[model samples]
Target chain A: MLHVFGHLNPDTDAITSAVVYAGLLTRQGVEARAFRLGEPNFETAYVLRELGVELPPLLPELPAGAAVALVDHNESAQSVENLAELRVLRVVDHHKLGDLTTASPPYLRFEPVGCTGTLLLKLHREAGLSIEQQDAALMLSAILSDTLHFRSPTTTGEDRDAVDFLAPVAGIKNVEAYALAMFAAKSDLGDTPAETLLRMDYKAFPFGDPAAPQLWGIGVIETTNPGYVFRRQGELLAAMDHVKAEDGLSGVLLSVVDILNETNHTLVLGATEAKVLREAFGVETQAQLANLGHLISRKKQIVPTLERYFAPDA
Target chain B: MLHVFGHLNPDTDAITSAVVYAGLLTRQGVEARAFRLGEPNFETAYVLRELGVELPPLLPELPAGAAVALVDHNESAQSVENLAELRVLRVVDHHKLGDLTTASPPYLRFEPVGCTGTLLLKLHREAGLSIEQQDAALMLSAILSDTLHFRSPTTTGEDRDAVDFLAPVAGIKNVEAYALAMFAAKSDLGDTPAETLLRMDYKAFPFGDPAAPQLWGIGVIETTNPGYVFRRQGELLAAMDHVKAEDGLSGVLLSVVDILNETNHTLVLGATEAKVLREAFGVETQAQLANLGHLISRKKQIVPTLERYFAPDA
Candidate 1:
């Protein structure tokens, strides 16, 4: 049997991508099962419930002796535990490659797209297969979530075509309105627990000297209005402190981004070479927070900034 | 228009693969042209002459602003001069990737096959297209040459299938006989000019500190009978010395391989670190030549040995 999943911290695209790709592999006479590496965030759960699709089983790690196919990501740091032990049959990702090597070449279909759903949609068409109505909507939702309703800089023409092809079949009358509604569903995080908020879309990165104890935990919270998260800044910082202690990380930075505004306000904890950070971003820290104006992406903008700051001098 | 070519020092596979893959791309509505990076070696010229196929034009370098697609090889060192310029449309290769990156992702169809022709055959079948007779023969010749008539360690089951599928279409009554004929055409190099022999299947690599000058010119001469080339050993060594002087290289080695016997004899020119070579191969040098018994592949065996010897201390 073949097991398929995305990178850790299962988001809307990661969950829907695994499900759709497994369907494609299954139609080709492979007994493939879609699973998630971790529990889905509220937005993903809400979308699945709306589409009336049962959530795949939550799997923390890939099972031993099973052939695994990864989707959405290829970074081992963000992949399941014991990833080096299993047989990797294939990989379908949209992100840049990380530290991944196989004894033999695994079939790779990596593209620089806004979402994995866009890639799978093309794959199905190329294989002469069709995605049905309910699944098509889920796939569309993933594209919207990843590309921020086609407003992201990563959105390409293929992504627009994927949205156009699926919207009618998905019974969506207005794509703009539908995307807005989806964004609204995840907006009210005011009453949520601080830990759940921090863990929603968390990623960890290691930097500086290889021997040094330094790791950065970054969490991104997408909202229509950035002020919602800013209101609870004190509580979120306390939660970030607890998260830093639990993970034994050197620092923690949270990107509270307003997708509608295309801006992110960064709140950080822990001391890590302020001189490097100030020089890299041309911003000074104010109360452990840096107001980064007009930041749309973590992968393209925020993460690269942090990585450059943490990179040791050559 | 897409211009497709192979690596430098055009081999039989390199020349024929460009021709067949250009046919595949042309069928898919792309105006493609096949060309060779350098002059064809004896075996490639012989096969083309038998098939009544015109040789691709010798293009020593790619033109600026031309959209190019590469086949058979992908190493920048072996690729066209000024490869960083121009638009790369696609890459169809069967070797380990080198330091190659594109401004954007090109249409990559890389596989770990014995030959690029084998991969193009699979692509045609997947796209529901057929290979015509003229192109089919070209593809078959490439497979035969790269796999050493299916005796090289790189030969796989897919390569066998390709040869089987193309044998009848190429109008060959006996596969073994056809392959032996091709091998025999390249065996009689006794009367050829020493410089031409050295340029037949030559490759160069840089090693050690980039600040200091160091280069290795490795040549492989495949023959059915090793003694035919061994008889001209003195002349070959003298030619190699001249090549070293002309190129101002640190070292040069030639692998005279007997494909029928599956063994290769190595001969070196110029002074390099003898202690490094001795520890790498664990064998003493005899007359500046080493009998690398039963090693026929430069990529898999000989080049790796030289690289290990030249590798700086970890």
Candidate 2:
């Protein structure tokens, strides 16, 4: 069986891309099963229902030691140690390289794009698969989320090309209208802080050194609403800080987006490394706050910027 | 079975509204089957598939043999002569009143919007039935098409309200993006003249007194590409003129739309009245060929303009 595994704390792109890609694979006579790293959020549920696609069952902790093919997020030895006992066939992602080992070195595809969905789209197009309208719509949604609805600068020609290809297939005359509507629906923040916090996927990363306290990055994506971003900022930062303190983290990074404007108000807590934020964004840090204007998506903006800051000086 | 029928030459609004309204009726213990007057074009197909919806089979020529519920387009005694044998229980449309009669006076819902989808949205929302994401997506598509993606001045607060209510349910963030994509997809002119002509729903309206030559109105809707308006003008006019000559028409009215700009280029072929076009649009006879600019929509703009021109005293 072709086992397709997606990243931890999966987004719409991570889940829908895997699902549609799996559908394409199945159509090609491949026995494929899709697995998600975490439970889906409200937005993902709405999209799946709209397309009449069933959400793949979430596999708790990666099948307790089965073969895995990583998608979207990079695989690490630490993350896959439990699953390492089983065979890993391939890895498809858009993230920077992480230390990963497989018995048989699998086909590793890592392109610098906004999201892994874009890569899957490229694969689908390259393979000449006939994309259905529902799948097209989902892929478009993933691109929008990854590229911040086409407002992010990190969006490339490939991203726009994919959107142009899928727009007609989706039968939507104005994708921006649909994006705005979907984002507006997501702006209602009536849930508790914990619920909101849990609704998002969080990833833990090694900071400076593996033992130098863990660092966590949290991303929240929504359609453009500056007011909503401004309102959620304090609470989100506080929650992350609380989580970090409880878990004993060196630092926690929170990226909340105003998708319409392609802007992200980034919050960094626990670390006095203003240089880290500064080097990442070229903006001088203020007392404790860093406002990365027009930096919307974590996938497209924050991560790459962080990678540059962490890289050796040119 | 509950008969869910929409206007002839069904657009996105007409088809989607029918589906959503049917779903609502079905949930309320009504066995509703959606009926369309003609084949769904590429644009309509995209939406149906994206929402995982299947367009109901075409209703061959109004099913004069079966009970019907007239929708969108108005009906007349001549139009229903075959259906006169079957009872028409209700008339749900968003067009100006048309000559229609039933053995027992049926429920008549004729609002002044561009498409009947708006009424379905109201009914679904008012009924308090849960509108699924696909249903909501379809409903939103209908509204966008009917209202020219909200660019038409004919759009009302009610239309906006329905859009606001349905947008989130569909998980669409930006309605314009969806609309643009759908419209661009439909701009292909690779089809034969007959196919292109048949792609849009057409209706016959006997204009003027019986003594006068019969006048027929034919319209074609494209989500985008106003250039097609000019390109197809001669062919459409010729087709109408041919039909007119064959049927001894006094005049024929044709409208082509650039839905994005909310503009319609119209050609009126007949000697009976250039005055109606002039009176309605404040266009002089000499300026008819000067590109009439944005004419809004056939239902909201042209019809109202014609009414005003025909009845200056009224």
Candidate 3:
């Protein structure tokens, strides 16, 4: 059986895309099961329960050469620890091409859309398969979460079309209401541990020369109420510092994204991250924060900027 | 305008797939033109002439950020000199995942099929576009050449189905006869320069640790007349030696594949190439030739074997 999954720090897209893709493959007579690298975020949990879908079980350590399919992400740093050892059967992703190599050719589908959900819908249509109502709901929720209800810079016409096509099938009458409720659920982080908050939507990235890339951990907290996060900035910074040292990361940052305002106010753990923000984004760090104005979409706005700044020739 | 092309040392699939895909994109209201990184091999030339289709012009160096699309191949080492600078808009490939990175997500479609033509047909269908007679002929020829008329181990069921579907559309009355003619055209190497023969279907690959990979150049000569290739062994070996030195490659290999017999007899340039063939395949070199029996598909058999042998853990 092929295990299907997405990246660690399971956001709505990462968690639900695995389920939708696994269901699609299963309908095509492939014995595949969805798995999560970590616990789903609050919004993802809300989506699963609201859609009456079961939470995917956490992935266990599999022996080398186990077949797997990846969704939403293709980067090894964001995937399973044994990614190199496993045999990747397929990848459905929306991120930039990553450090992925296979012994043989595999099925790969990547598009520059806001969400993997948009690509999954296309895949189902291409396969001449009817989308299940639950799967459609999962895809709709994921698209809304990933695109921030079409407010993100990464949102494309295809994404909007997907939502429009899937809304009725998913039994969603008002997408705006559902999206706001999901955001509310996402922001309902009452006294969650500092480390848990920092890890909810984090990913490790390698920059500079690929041979000896500098590893950095970046976390994001997307919510309508950014002030709620700012109140716990002290704890979040301490957790970030601890994670940076523990993971031997070159630097660490946590971007608190104001979803409604479409702005980014990133917390800097140290001088290293501050220097990168200053040099890479021309933003000064004050009071342990860097205001990366209107740079809310990490995949579109933040990561690419940092990638160019740390490029080997740069 | 988007320029579509394949890998260096363009083969039938490499040259024709670009033309077919470019035409597909153009019909969809995107201004895309096909280009070739290198001159077409004899078989590709025959296909173009027989179909009365113009040869894709050789690609010139483009300015940084020029929009481009890749077909047949994706690895930077096998691509244009300024591949890193070019903006890759889409990639339709049938090869393993390569060291490709982008600033943003791009349209990527990869499958472990025998030919890119199969995927191109699917792409055209998904786009709700009709395949023109000329485009169909190009795809059919590419599928036949790449799969060695379904003799190669890389040939899959989809490739056979594609050929069956395309034969009528391409207006080819006798499929077998057409395939034999293509093979004959590919085999007619009559007095071509040794260097030219060696480079007609060659690609550079990087193996071992990705940070500092060991680069090797692999060349394949697939034909119905293997005796003719072996007869020019000395000159070919000299050409291989010159390329290995000139390119500063770690190793160079030229495999002469007998399409009918389904066998590989590779020329070993030096001690480095000889040792790798021996250790990797357990085949002894005799008279500077290593018999890699029944390993006719380079993409399926030879490259993967070498990749595993050169793996960091291996």
Candidate 4:
């Protein structure tokens, strides 16, 4: 059986895509089960509860050479620690290609869309399989969460079409209300530790040259109430410092995104990150904060810009 | 407009896949034109002539950041010189992932199938596009050539199904006879320069550590009349030596495959390749020849073995 899962810091898209993809594979006669690399974030948990679906079990360490399928991510840094030892059977992602290699070819499906849900929908259609109502709901919620209800710059026409086609099957009467409720659930941090908050949607990335790339940890907090996050800026910076040192990261960045306003206010961790932001974005960090206005989508707006900045030629 | 092309040292699948994929994109309202990175091989030329289809023009150097689509291969060592500078808009490949990175996500489609033609057929069906007679012929010929008429280890059920479905649409009554004719054309290497023969189906691969990987050139000559090739063993070895030196490759090996017998007789270039083959395959080189018996498929049989042998742990 193929063990299917997504990246660490399981967001709604990452968690839901694994389940939906596992279902698709099973329906196509492949024995597969969904697993999550980490605990689901609050929004994903809310989505699971509202849809009356059980959360996918957290993945345990598997023996080396175990066959697995990756969804929503292909980067080794964002995946399991023993990724190099495992035999990757399939990958479904929507991010820039990263340092992932296999001894043989695998089934890989990638597109520059807002979410993996859109690709899952395409997979179902191509396979001539009808989407189960639960699967449809899972995909619909993931699409809205990832695309920020079509407000994010990552939103593509294909994503919009998928939502339009799936809404009826998902039995979603008011997408706006559901999205708002999800966002509210996400924003309800409610005394969670600063480290937990910082890690909720975090990922590690390697930048600069392919050989000897510098590792960096990037975290995102998407919420309706951005002010609530900024109020704990001191604690978040301490958490970032601890993580950067523990992981030996070259830099760390935490972008607190205001979902409703569609703005980004990133917390600069140290001199390394501050200098990089200043040189890359021409924005000065004041009081340990960089007001990266209108940069709401990390996959669309942030990662690409940082990639170009750290490009070998650049 | 997207310029679609295949890898250097173009094979039948590489050349034809570019054309068929360009056609698929055009059918989807994408402005795309096929190009070839290098001259077509004898079998590809024969397939083009047999179908009365014009060969794609050789690709010209475009400015940095020009959008392009890749088919058949994706590794940088097998691609254009300035592959890193260009923007890859789409990639349809059937080989193991290599050092491919994009600033943003692109449309990537990869499968563990025998040929890119199989994946192109899937793309057309998913898009609800009818296969044109010419495109069907191109795909069928590619499948036959890449899989050696279903004799290659790389051949999958999807590849067989594709040929079965495409035979009539391609207007080919006898696939066996057609495949034999193509092979005869390919085996007609004739008085071609030894260097040309060595490069006809060659690719450079980076093995060992991805960071500062050691580059090796692997070439294959698949022919029905293996005796014709063995007669020129001296000249071929000289050609391999020249390529290894000229490219500063760590090692080079040219496998001369007997298409009829499904056997491999690889010519070891120097001490490096000899030691690797000895350690990896437990085969000793005699008279500069290493008998890699029954390992005919370079992708499915050869590269993976070499990769495992050079793995960091191993």
Best prediction by DockQ:
3
Error of 1 at B2 (Å): 3.2
Ranking by lDDT: 3, 4, 1, 2
Instruction: Provide per-model DockQ scores.
Output: 0.14, 0.00, 0.82, 0.80
Tens digits of lDDT, candidate 1, A257-295: 788887777876645633444676776777767767776
Ranking by DockQ: 3, 4, 1, 2
Cα lDDT of model 3 by residue, A1-314, tens digit: 99999999999999999999999999999999999999998899999999989999999999999999999999999999989899998999999988888778999999999999999999999999998899999999999999999999999999999999999999999999999999999999998999999999998889898878999889999998999999999999999989998999999999999988889999998888999999999999999999999999888888888999999988
Query: Model 2: residues >4 Å from true position, as ranges?
Result: A60-65, A77-81, A192-195, A198-201, A209-214, A221-223, A232-234, A270-275, A278-288, A308-314, B1-314
Candidate 1 achieves a global lDDT of 0.79
* Candidate 4 collision pairs: none
Give the Å shift of residue B92 in candidate 3: 0.7
DockQ of 2: 0.00
Summing lDDT over every window of 10 consecutive residues in candidate 2 chain B, give the lowest-scoring window: B97-106
Q: What is the interface RMSD of candidate 3, in Å?
A: 0.9
**Chain A only: TM-score per candidate:** 0.93, 0.84, 0.99, 0.98
- Candidate 2 C-alpha lDDT tens digits along B276-299: 666556665442332357775555
List ranges where model 4 is wrong by over 4 Å: A270-272, B270-275, B284-286
